[model samples]
Target chain A: MVLPSFSNPGAGPADAVVAASPTAPLDAFLDNQPQTFYESIYRSEAACLCILRLLPPVCRQIVLHVLWSHQTLKSADLKAFCGMDERLAPDAAEEVIRPARDRHIFLSLNHKGNKFQWPLSDTFKRGLRNALTGLGTSNSFGAPYARGPRDEVPTAEALTDYGEDTWESILKYMVSSGLTNGYRGGRPRNSVLLLLYQSGLMADPYDRSGHNPKLEALTITSKGFQFLLEDRQTQLWQILMYYLAGKQARGENAADILSLFFSLGCMQLGQDYSASESFPHMENVLDDLEQYGFVYRTEMGRERGQFFPTHLSTTLCSGESGASRSQSADDKRFLILETNYKIYAYTSNDLEIAILNLFVNIRIRYPNLVVGRLDRRHVKAAMDKGIAAGQIISYLNSHAHPQMYNHPPPILHPSVTDQLHLWDKERNRLGAQESVMFEFFSRELFDETRDEAERNAGLHLALPAKKLLFVDPNVREAIKDFIKDKQVQLRGGI
Target chain B: MSYHDPYQVKASNGTLITCDSAAKQILIHLDAQRDGPQKFIIRDVDDTHVLIKSIYVDMVRTSLQEELEKNTYDQDPAL
Candidate 1:
């Protein structure tokens, strides 16, 4: 179940920097969970495998090494095992060992001799060993369903289409929700609709109480706009994270649900699993996931039905491979931007068109081509609604037509990208700072006060003619003392 | 030399507005309209800056947007 690292070998230095931490969504989610939750999560072999695959390379190596031995490890022992030099050992211990300890993967113990030692959690060790050896009776990896010749299972292509269609409909709902007419497509399930609202991706502007608002009433929030711009993998993980959070909030068994997700992540795509045998208690969870396009289930016969994990579920832990494959399949380069700020998109898909309509002013639509213009107003409107300039540019660049890529670099016309940025910047023309204003002072008093303020590095603004000064609020008392001293000296001179 | 307070220090909540000279002029014009209960601009800081009541920041931004839109040429239609 150990999936290969999906970090692109051809990625640049920036990607390498990001790869250093390798903070997958699962890693971030696990980091926030309490120790008790980790104990629960470690009980499932599939969940253990998923956590191992998601850990940073260094930490994964350390965990594997600790899995076989009963010996307690000290800091120096871990450093030596990592093969680090003396100077870098402490730093490595801080950067790598600390997070592992915090994650409860490593248990620190006070030995009888007053020496501190780290041991792997017993639950994690047992689960991981069973996952590696394939010797567990837990059936956490899923039990295969015996299908007869007459039983019709979906082809991989159909499953992919099913997943994509269901997932895209959800995205389409989000995008269309922002429109004046609102989303007209088939609405997602009520649970999903609630999750969308709870996640703050969509909000009901009219509903003050926020209690189970209708799908039509929900508008795409700023977070939703940003979510639409993310690659499919990140977007899916984000939704799943929100779904888990909602489950936890509703007093559900989140650890069990989480373990099920991890098992689903490790399951084979296109293989039928006996739903009754594997997850008899998780019927509601499976049904909800069906709405989210994670699994396709057959109707129940005399016995409980079989469910097939779609590409979405199998590739959950595989990360970028799934995203890149899906991108190549459906997210081909289709946009062309010109120097005149006109955009031509070669897409007829309603979902793609809806996403484009978020920021582009469409002029006309042919059968397979969309003509639009990047107007300041439309871009500003999108920005006001919570989309960033960088997101817009990156979206355009990632989706630019192949012809645009034929040019050396800067695929989109520089003028067009620059204007889009300038349009965003125009909204931020006025910078505001809060300060205390000192006005109506005599020229002599103003000069003296300004000098003292400047010396204290507290002056915000100075107007010689108006005899006014705005100083930092932090230095007001000191400026007042200086002014009072000046007044006393003037009075004594008189 | 009179016995009055040498200077007055007013602790009013104000936002120091910073922008280009052209935008500052538009802001000055906006302050002069006095459309709300109070004036928008507290003091003209300089050619390129102004201090205004913090509450009026959004009002100032919208008016500026409308004004800028009028002056800006539509490049898309030009082609």
Candidate 2:
């Protein structure tokens, strides 16, 4: 099945705009083939928790209400939670259940001689309950370390710092590939790189089918461009989903692996947990995750070593935007766009520079900043690579410098925004579209054919003066049949 | 992230109809509804030569409608 577009079908202008821009993990799941996504989710407990977290607040509530029970919950049963009285139609309740059902979060169960009803996902049920209440006996919430001198445990601030640094380091690794001399740091773990290739976020230019590490042959795919701008949680879920799917394919117990990680996310940040708590499940993957900074380990040499979940893990379930100011506060300002085409990003973060270099022409570099201009060639290069003008504009708009942000409209210069799109639109000026070219017909016949094709939404281009027309290939057969019928009629009449 | 829409603006009656051809490019800016003077630009797509001058709103509208009716201008007019 084709991936559904990121845009919501009937969203209003404002929502349509948001939907047009990429980076929604929920939308990604929706856009993905259901069988693949469902298999991915059910294979791991953490993937289940991720689906719960990725859903909108209302949808999550639906999952929570039905989570405890194993019985098939009728869509009508949800009426009590929603307080939709007898006045509300049963179909309305079904409508309420539709989104979750569509996403396969609620599987339809076939009870013997009974109406089909949505069954709460068991793996998700257990994992979410443990995550929310922290009362479950299962090791799904992470194991607590034996009482230790608390002074040795790392603080939340330190973990957040570690998470940010390592996360940036991974991005730096990715961004380096876009540069002339590739990024020189110790690369991210092989598993993470493989996840990138599997997720189609990055591809080897020479070898589209397989990756060879020795050649360092990978270019960030267009999907990678948007992936770079995703918030940490979305990025984490995207990566983790791919990781779980890959492991599951290899016959590993990926479901347990996912659950173990979800437990890690549920644990208190900076709290020390014994490795045995998560046990055999976390033992192998924990080292791989360390490269992602999802967790930090102290005293790796010891058998019962302690692991602390970083900000990345802690923020996985509930993002920080739950506060009253539900949207972002202007705390993050990474890019500055000037009135002129020049862009001055205030941080020599190599990853950020490499990303900017993708669509913006870099002119000069400084210790703290890199100066760049977004010209036609720079924009076309990104467009040619499959990154849309809208995504680049959205990234710049979101990451605009604090001073640049004017309340009603975000702070990037209007010209820069318009020109980026204009350049992107320019790429579409002569895009190749396959169509059936019709020519050498009489003027009267041509007019008749053109009118019929246009009415049917099959006409591609028409040259009335030349009595030539082009139409969609699918409709060509019909036109040919009509022409044959006309020829027969002419012969019969003659 | 909050985005500033450069194309869309509040309460501006100005409409920009851009049409591309094999030989030339045209941009017709009509602001008659907003009671502002209008202009249109015709330039070679190959960047050979440029022609820019003011035009009456009716002329731009007629030209735009002619192009629109012919289905040559596939892009919707930007408001």
lDDT of 1 by residue, B1-79 (tens): 3447555444555788878787898888777877666787877878777888888888888889899988887664646
RMSD of 1: 7.5
**Cα lDDT of model 2 by residue, A223-287, tens digit:** 77667766455677678777777787889865466556656666787787777665554577877
Residue pairs in candidate 2 whose N, alpha carbon or C atoms collide under 3 angstroms: A43-A255, A46-A258, A404-A411
- lDDT of each residue in A123-173, candidate 1, tens digit only: 888999999999887788998998888888889888888898899999999
TM-scores for all candidates? Answer: 0.80, 0.67
TM-score of chain A of each: 0.79, 0.74
Task: For candidate 1, give the lDDT of residue A450.
Answer: 93
Give a tens-digit lDDT track for model 2, residues B1-79: 1243211111111212223542133332332233423333422212322232324334644554444446533222231
